[model samples]
Target: MSVEAELIAPAELGTSVVSDKGESIAPQAKEAASGLLDQGDAMTSLAQQAPSVVERMQDFLLVGGPVVWILLGFSIIALSIVLVKLWQFALLRPESNRDVTQALALWRAGEHGQATVVLKRNRPVSELVYIAMRGVLNVRQDMDLLKDELERVAALRLNQLRALLRPLEVIATLSPLLGLLGTVLGMITAFQRMEAAGNQVDPSVLSGGIWQALLTTAVGLAVAIPVVVIHSWLERKVERVAAVMSDSVTQVFTGQQISVVAEPELEELKRAA
Candidate 1:
């Protein structure tokens, strides 16, 4: 019998068997069972210790003796802001670089109505383009007034883009200072103890106290660095949106000018015809 046949039939559980090809089915079965048992033991160990792992993290964050539960609070706030911005950015990402370029090409070609229709199809960069081109369609509308309205709308969109960013900026600014304050407090406490001990102070105690004080500074930096990075990234996204608005508005104004200048020539041609 082949090893495969032996595995499927397994003549007897835990019994020795030699395949017709002289392969040892017994050993293979034993090894497979051993692997399964090892995996089971590992999973059981993890299941048993899962609660302790969470408990340990909770205890450390809550009791990591040093300067600033307030620093921890700042970290939490920064994290919340980061997450919210990430979600907002993901939803509002500018998705039509090529489509917008094509639509703008149409606008510049003196096809203002068709350009807006093309932009409408893109769904992302097109909204601003559509809004700008709306004013272009109405020739009697003052271009400057239309431009001013676009700016106001752009400002509101930008405000929305940067909504929670202020909190992140605040967190990045204050975490280090809070950490430094903690370090100072820790050093003061250590020195007060040394003074109280009056020549009997242990060197180890002083060293331990100094390190405890430094821990706050380390954690504060850890929180601040990532927050600064994320804040800068979010700011860049806002700038990208602004750039899109500017580019689309420029296209609208160009199309308007082209259409406006062409009108008198068309009338002259009509009179001649």
Candidate 2:
């Protein structure tokens, strides 16, 4: 009976240990399953909401009527112009100045050939500097004629940079007015509806109409603000480029004048020696 009791005690102890481990693992398993279920439910909810969000946007646009559509078109056109101007700036690098500085230094030091080579870069300022240096060294044209020619070239370059900027300005200027027009029209429509409804007019209807009328103004401002900022920034960039070109060309001519004045003095000193 004692041997049977000892054997039974060990078997019971082992069964209790297994039960304890199972109890601990069961809650952990349930927690992991609940976490996965929660994540799946969130993902499913987002998927269901996506189409509804799109529908709401479409309805909002439709409610704003033709003025909103016109603003939409303007926004697209503005975006396209901005992209084109950015690409043009990137390709031309109108802001590049280091090469122009180096070329001017070489020209001042009497290294005309090297200076011309230095100005060979694909930059607007470089092109202007190259033309000025070439005119002085090779053409030996009158300073007034050269200045006139440079002015023409500068005008052309500036015009290129200024391209499409007018359209952007127009868009920025017109957007708010168009939005105001839309709001006014919407307000007129809303009030007319209220007038038609007469004694049956509900406050909700008026409130809805007011908000919907205001929506055009909100969208117009949204479209105009960025466009105004972009236009100013782009205009400033062109101005900087123009300044650099003027400064560089002026330096080249100034250096040429100094050289011209010094050459006669050197010749006289040589004769005296």
Candidate 3:
């Protein structure tokens, strides 16, 4: 009986030891696995966040680029000038074809006052017709004197038309030079910054200065191109008007009904002015 009890006690002790070992190892293994899972999650979060940070930086540069702002400013000023000049030219048409027929009718009717009234009422071409009519008014008008006076009046009217266009020429001439000056200044600044940074400088550190340099050049061209185009168009319009005035003056002088007679008083008046 004593032997049997001792054997049973040993078996029970061995079973209890096996159970304790399993309990300790199971909790430790679970904790290590949880730690690995948390580390994987943190790594994935960092990977996703990195692309977002880079994309934000790219967006900022694209929108706030210096070149875009410079171009915008150049376009606004140049286009504004072009639009105003276009409106001015539209308003400056020569006297209508009807004016020629109407003036001839007034001359044939032997009513000089009504003819003068007709010429005066028209605004744009009034100055040209007014000068020619003055020649007709003289009792002794020399053909040479009449020709010279009409030419002078035509030139004066053209000068008035070209009054404000000098600024357009100035902008066309100076814009490129101003851009070059800006480029030179930007380069100097960039070099100074590079020198200060020494070996630590990245090439991208000079990107702002480079952007400024390029933008100034582009802006200069933007202003110059349209000014040149509009200036040429205006010059052609002036030429056409001058030709029309010349033809009209020639017709008036060559008409046999209007005789040319030389007057000494008219010559004196022209010389005094």
**Candidates by TM-score, descending order:** 2, 1, 3
Candidate 3's residue-wise lDDT over 1-273, tens digit each?
699999999999999999899998999999999999999999999999999999965654353355435545655666777778677766655535466557656754566667666664344456566567667778698867877877787788888667557766766777676667666766777788889999999788698768756666766676678777887777677777777777766655554254333356668889999
CA displacement after TM-score superposition, residue 178 of candidate 3 (Å): 1.1
Report the C-alpha displacement of residue 53, candidate 2, in angstroms.
Answer: 2.5
Give model 3 RMSD, 1 decimal. 20.2
TM per candidate comes to 0.74, 0.87, 0.55
For model 3, what is the alpha-carbon lDDT of residue 55? 99
Which window of 10 residues has the lowest lDDT sum in candidate 3? 253-262
Per-candidate clashes come to: 0, 0, 2
lDDT of candidates 1 onward, in order: 0.77, 0.92, 0.68
Candidate 1: tens digits of C-alpha lDDT, residues 1-273? 988887867565434444432465667888999999999999999998998999976765554464457777788788778888777767666644666777778887776667767664324456767777777778687978987888887787788888988888888998888778878888988898899989898998789779778878888898889999999988887888788878777867776677679989999999999
Say which prediction, candidate 1 or candidate 3, comes out ahead on TM-score: 1
Maximum-lDDT candidate: 2
> What TM-score does candidate 2 reach?
0.87
Off by over 4 Å in 3: 1-84, 95-98, 101-126, 257-273
